[model samples]
Structure formats: C-alpha cells, structure tokens
Target: MTLKEATLVTGGSSGIGRAICTMLLEAGRTVVNLDYVLPQWSHPNLVNFQADLTDAAQTRERAQEIVSQYAITALVNNAGATRPGTIDTATIDDLDYVVALHLQASLILIQACLPALRACGNGRIVNMSSRAALGKPERVVYSATKAGLVGMTRTLAMELGGDGITVNAIGPGPIATELFRKSNPDGAPRTQKIIDSIIVKRLGTPEDVARATLFFLSPENSFITGQVLYVCGGVTLGTATL
Candidate 1:
C-alpha cells in the first residue's frame, strides 16, 4: 500500500505559516507543524508538534521523528522572527537569538529531513525568505539571515536535484501579517509609503504568499528550482502602479 505523503512546516501557528498549513491541508496533503505556539485552528489532516525550532537539539529530534512517522514530501521553513535595530542599537544577543531561530534552526531541520526527502522522490522544500533579505532599514540581522536562506536554497537545489528534491524560496514584501503590523501599523505614514511603493498599491496577504508556495510545490513546477519568487504585489519592480 502507498503511504500518505505529508508536508512539514515550522512556525505554523500564525500568519504566513498558518496560511501555508491551511493551504497545504486544503490541497489534500497531510501537514505536520513544528511550533512552540499552539494554533487557533485545527484539522484532522493537520498534526501539531509543539517544539521550539530555535532549540537545535529538539528541532532535530522532532524533524527526524516526523519523517520516520510520515512520508514528508515537502518542508517549508517558515519559522523566523525579527529583531529590529539600527547599527548602533543591534546587539550581539539579537544576532545570536535570530541566528538560532532563523539560520541554524533551518539547517538542523534540513539535515534531519534530507534522508527521508531523498527517499520520497520528487520532494519539495520552500524557504520563507523576505524582501527584507535584499535590504531593510533597522533590520540588518534579519536581512542577513533571510539572505542566507536564499543562498542556502540555491546551493541545496543544485546538490539535491539529482535526488529529485527541488529547493526554492519565497520572498514576500510588506505582507500584512501580525508580524508586519507589529512594526508597520495601519494608517501610519510609513505604512502608506510602503503601500505606494507596491505596484499593486496594496499590502500582500498571507494567502498570496501561500499561493506562491503552492506553485513552487506543484508537480508541474518540476523544472523550477534554486529560484526565489517574490510575492510582493510587484513591489520589487520599484514603482507603484498608482
């Protein structure tokens, strides 16, 4: 009998991660979420593992266990938090913690899942990078880590291509998730400027990013890898539509 294939997602308790989990589950794929936070919703097809991904040892343990219990065909590294600070204010501690949660945790998860992903055939891996990766003010560390994820995505795509595992990244811009709003409040001038810069003249939604992720995971998208898809209302174009 064929075993059911599943997608493993980190930080799936809220915002973009939650949206990805919802979309994957709706696609008839089983989903396992690794997050220390409990989500507000649930489905029979969705399984939650309350593991803090920042903890490397625990991350490896849970990732291995999940792969052993399920055919993990896809992995979405969507767990990241920002520590906003200018050059003067950014502390070494900020760098350390974000690195643990962002870069190191992803590395650990990927390493743990490599064997199962190789065995699964046609496996997919999506890293949730941000336009901040290109460069964002007061977000030096966040930018660096997200940029690193992009670099890792490129390298892994080539290294794992022969294994039929595709790796890519989604770089979202000014998404209106809880995380985004924490810094860019609605009706604020800064927020307005961000909207105006978007060619779509609007902030991106979690669903928009989720759809891009699904596109990358699609069987028809087999030829696409080592690439970053920017789901940012065309903000990357550098001019607003209005």
Candidate 2:
C-alpha cells in the first residue's frame, strides 16, 4: 500500500480534527481537509476544500471533487458546531445547526462518496463522537447528535462491509483544547477531576484522540467496524467524574 491513498477529514482546520489530519499526513497519506476554515499550514499532500458542511449541496460537491482529485480511501466526519445551553434556552436555530453539521452532513457526504469508497478496496470511515453521549445531560442536543453518529457508524458498517469498507467511531473525553477551555471556564479544575478519576490521571490531548482515530483507519483495522472506541483515560470504566 502506497502513501498516496487519500484520507478526507472534515473540521481539519483546528482542534482534534487538525490533529487527525497531521497524523495521517505524517503517516504518508494524502490528506484532504474539508472545512469552512483553512489551517495555517502548507503541504503538497494536504488538499484543502473549504465548504459549508451543513449545506448538503456543498458537501456532496466537495465529496465528488475529493474523489475525482484523489484516490480517496478513507472518510473522517469530524466537523461539528455547538451552541451550549439547556434545551429550554437553546434556540431553534442553534439546534438546527447542530443537527445539520453533526448528523445530516455526515450522512450526505457518506452517501455522496459511497461509489468512490467502494472502488477503493479496504476503504475506511470514522466518525468523531463524544463521551457526553454516554450519560451526560448538560448538552442535550450535542449528545443526541453524537449518539446519532454512533448509529450511522453501525449502519454504514453493515451496508458497506461487503464492499470492503470499514466504519467506526472515536469518542474523546475532557481533551485540553482551546475549545474545551472556552466551553468550561473552570475547565482546568474539571479536567483535573476527570483525570484523577480516570486510570490515567491526565487530561487527554488532541494527539491522543488523533492517534486512536488513526489506529481505526489503518489498513490493519479491517476487522474492527461499528465499534465506538472511547480514547478517554478510562472514562468508560466509570472512573470519570462529571
């Protein structure tokens, strides 16, 4: 297998998505970053496609463009937006945007890229999920959308399995990113609490989530599909504190 095999990742401009893009590029893969914002980096193998993922037409067009321009073998749905607040306070527009970006966009892109993915033997698909989907009730809309991603992963795995494509998801817990800090003003303390409760007493880094994503997308991960692997420091073990 050559490094020219392309991996397309949405939300590659920043946060965990950026980390995932860098890792895949470093591993000698052609990386296509689909996002509304562009990253401050330059690489011949890194292809940037600026598109409003929430817009179905834009997503479909870009998906086609990526396949036409590269030998695409993987798709990573990581682009998402959040309007943090309780359901009562969350606006209709906010909820709509969340669903559009997190749920609808992924579905549209996968459908648009199916033919290309099927053509590339051993193709892979990964959805970036959240630990909040487990039991957290704070961001109800966000959690619901992420949980929907898990369902998409499983269904796609079944549908695309016969075509030699694998689908899986990764959930990150309390990652120390700028977004995380802004989302929780006292995030540091909260992160610390989560760390102390985890088997590994440290907040996870963007790289940690990226690495797990890479593992699932690797050629060796052919047998692993429909699995939501949480890259948190033992959060799934009931070790994490809210």
Per-model TM-score on C-alpha atoms = 0.94, 0.90
Mind giving the per-residue lDDT tens digits that candidate 2 earns over 47-123? 89899988888888887777767767788999976667786777778778889999988988787667778887798
Indicate the worst ten consecutive residues by lDDT in candidate 2. Answer: 183-192
What would the per-residue lDDT of candidate 1 be over residues 1-242, giving only the tens digit for each residue?
45567888999999999999999989998999999888989999999888887778888888778877877788999988888898899999999988888889888888878877888788899999988887888999899989899999999999999999999999998899998898899999999998998888999999999999999988678899999988888766753122
Q: How many backbone clashes does candidate 1 have?
A: 0
Most accurate candidate by TM-score = 1
Question: Cα lDDT of all candidates, in order?
Answer: 0.88, 0.83
What root-mean-square deviation over C-alphas does model 2 reach?
Answer: 3.2
Candidate 2 global TM-score: 0.90
